[model samples]
Target: MKKLLLLLVAVIGLSSCNKDSQEPRPVVPEGEGQPISVSFTGEVEDDSPRALEGTVNGSPAGKLLSFRGKGDVYGWVYVVDKDGEFAKGYKKLKVSEDGRSLSYEGTVPTTRSGGGTIDNATAKVSIYIGLDASGVFTNKGFKSIENVGHASGSSLGDDFAILKSENNALTYVSRSISGKYHEYKASNGKLSFSMAGSLILIRFRNEFQSPSHKVLWRKISGVLIKVADGAPLTRDPAIIDQMRVMNLHIDKIKIAVKDGNTQLTGTNEPSSGFIDNSTRYPNGYFFNLAKTVSIPTNTNRGVNSPFDNRESVIAFYTPISKRVDGRAGELAAFSFRLQNEAHYKEERFEDGLFSMASHRSVTFRSELEEGRVHRALLNITYQHVEGGGKN
Candidate 1:
């Protein structure tokens, strides 16, 4: 019996030793494709391609992939997988002077007896970038990314290389830590991305301008209301809600042209107000409308000042999808009309009617646009000139 117990102990120790011998190697359970998140950042030296030099960090096979994001006129991304993920350091990549690209190389892992099979796949990428008339990087709402092909090798983590096209620019591709990224494109189409922890999709957009790039229409008005005592300007529920919906802030609004060029595109700081948006679409356009109607005063309502019952709703139709930024020269021909009507009780004032209309054919330049609701906000402008009231 003692001998039997001793034999069992020996066998158990050998089994434990064998189990502990296996290294920490990651394997994605058999699945067609697994989720991955990639992010990069860099600076641009010139204006041609959108790629720049930056650092890359992401979960590669559920482990952090460390590498450098190389830049050509266009940009390409390459990650170096050392023998172990926790191991430090990697290789650097660069491109030729002509704007053609470069790549990164790696080695794979193997098992005993050379029996296990794993794909040794390498990435080949091509890139294109567009901006808008505003000198802003407009990507409609997102950029387009395509992979030429991924060549597979014999074993897991085998030596592989990522190649770039001879003529293609290296466009930068990246995502946030949370894995949210925008892809601006010129054509209307749907896209799917393997986000960090989720599967995301881009729906096709159809519009002259993307809603993200579209402006909210509103009118800034200065009216004298019949408030007996102290009244909070925000007490007006409708007025408060308007502030939340539109980018309406009461400040001096100045309109100027880009270098006095009628056919100008983006607004130079001296000429236009800049609109802020995400990287999906970064360009904007400014066109002149032949119609600029002014309402002197509210003659229809029983009021003392120029502002009584006067309002304006700026309207605009935005593109259905996000266009590439820096491609702002693209425009949508739109017919816009500004309509205003003021009604006054006959007993309230001498004249009981006031109305104004403005219609014009304006082309809206939008490359960095998404088919969401663009802003077309109009500010209420109450002509504060004296005698403007219908006395």
Candidate 2:
């Protein structure tokens, strides 16, 4: 019995020793090295044609959430580390089909030293809506991003235009993004955001004297505006009456190197000449104000106008500078004049006098409040002096 008991004791001791000698397994921390979930949420704050309704159009589609890629609406993210300039780079988050939501999930570099890891506090993000992810929109700051379209270009630094081109098919035509930057810092590994659009809404109507002796409002074609300093030019005394052009035309819009159109066609030639580069006026750029509206017949005119008595509203993402002393002052002095489509016709104006198209341009300056839609009402009456009031 004692021998058997001693043998059992020996066996148990050996087993315990074997277990103690074995190496311990490693342990892992919770929520480490996991992709962060990002979600987009929010509606644009805008002025609705109806004072109480807000923006008549719904929210925009295809919102872009970029980390540090190029200035484009869509591009690759280069880095994930926040400390390093190239650390946590660019990424194009996926916008939901409805455009009401945008979501992204990925691990960003945790450190500037080069290894990729997931981090909550270090990751930052920027948002863009109603702007091209491509490097197209020139003047609005889309090319400002470093290495946007070049071998080293990133397309991540340029400012985007507010116009929603066909490229942004997912986004609404009228909805635009407020050119503002946003930061991402989520503790629970989740990111959510809201964005608003800053647009200058100009509602205009064309009033013409009808045979009935009553002034009637109607829709006309070729509605465009020129970004010029101060009011529209009356009659330039310097230029001969034949060469005197009053309204700025699209083909005449000038674009300089700093303006960012130089790199577009890969050429350095002047963008546009007549009105764009003229020393006579401060017309900085030319943009088609709105899609060409079909002319309505005289009988088509009714008590009600299109879209709540609003003939057309030009939603402009003002690219004017904010500096009061600098370009801002120049822009503040700027006004948008309607082009006299007739003047461009193969036939010239009746006489030497310039036909005031859409009457005249009003001041284009307005307060830029985030999410606020600035409103301007311009009533254009065709002022036709019989026989073309010549100077």
TM-scores, each model vs. reference: 0.18, 0.42
Report the lDDT tens digits of candidate 2 across residue range 1-391.
0100000000000001122221232221212232233323322222121221111222111011121211113322222323422222234445444333334444332223333432333433333332232322223310111211123222111232221100000111121134221233332333333222233334344443222221222223532232222323232111001111112111211212221111112122222222342466543443332233222212232212223322323433332213122444343222344344443211113233233434334443333443333444444444533344333
Q: Compare the candidates by lDDT and give the number of the best one.
A: 2
* Number of the top-ranking candidate, with TM-score as the measure: 2
User: For each candidate, what is the lDDT?
Assistant: 0.19, 0.27
Instruction: Return the lDDT, model 1, position 23.
Output: 26
Tens digit per residue, CA lDDT, model 1, 1-391:
0000000000000001122222232332222222222222222122211110111112111110111121322222221111111111122223333222233322111111222211122211111111111112211111111110111101111001111111111222333345432211111121111101100011111111111111112222643333232222211111111111011111111111222111112232321222332243223333232233232331122111111122222222211123223343654322222222221101111222211222222333433232111222122221222222342
lDDT of 1 at 312: 22
- Among all windows of 10 consecutive residues in model 1, the one with the lowest summed lDDT is 5-14
- TM-score of model 1 vs. true structure: 0.18
Model 2 lDDT on a 0 to 1 scale: 0.27
TM-score of 2: 0.42
Alpha carbon deviation, residue 390, candidate 1 (Å): 16
Error of 1 at 174 (Å): 22
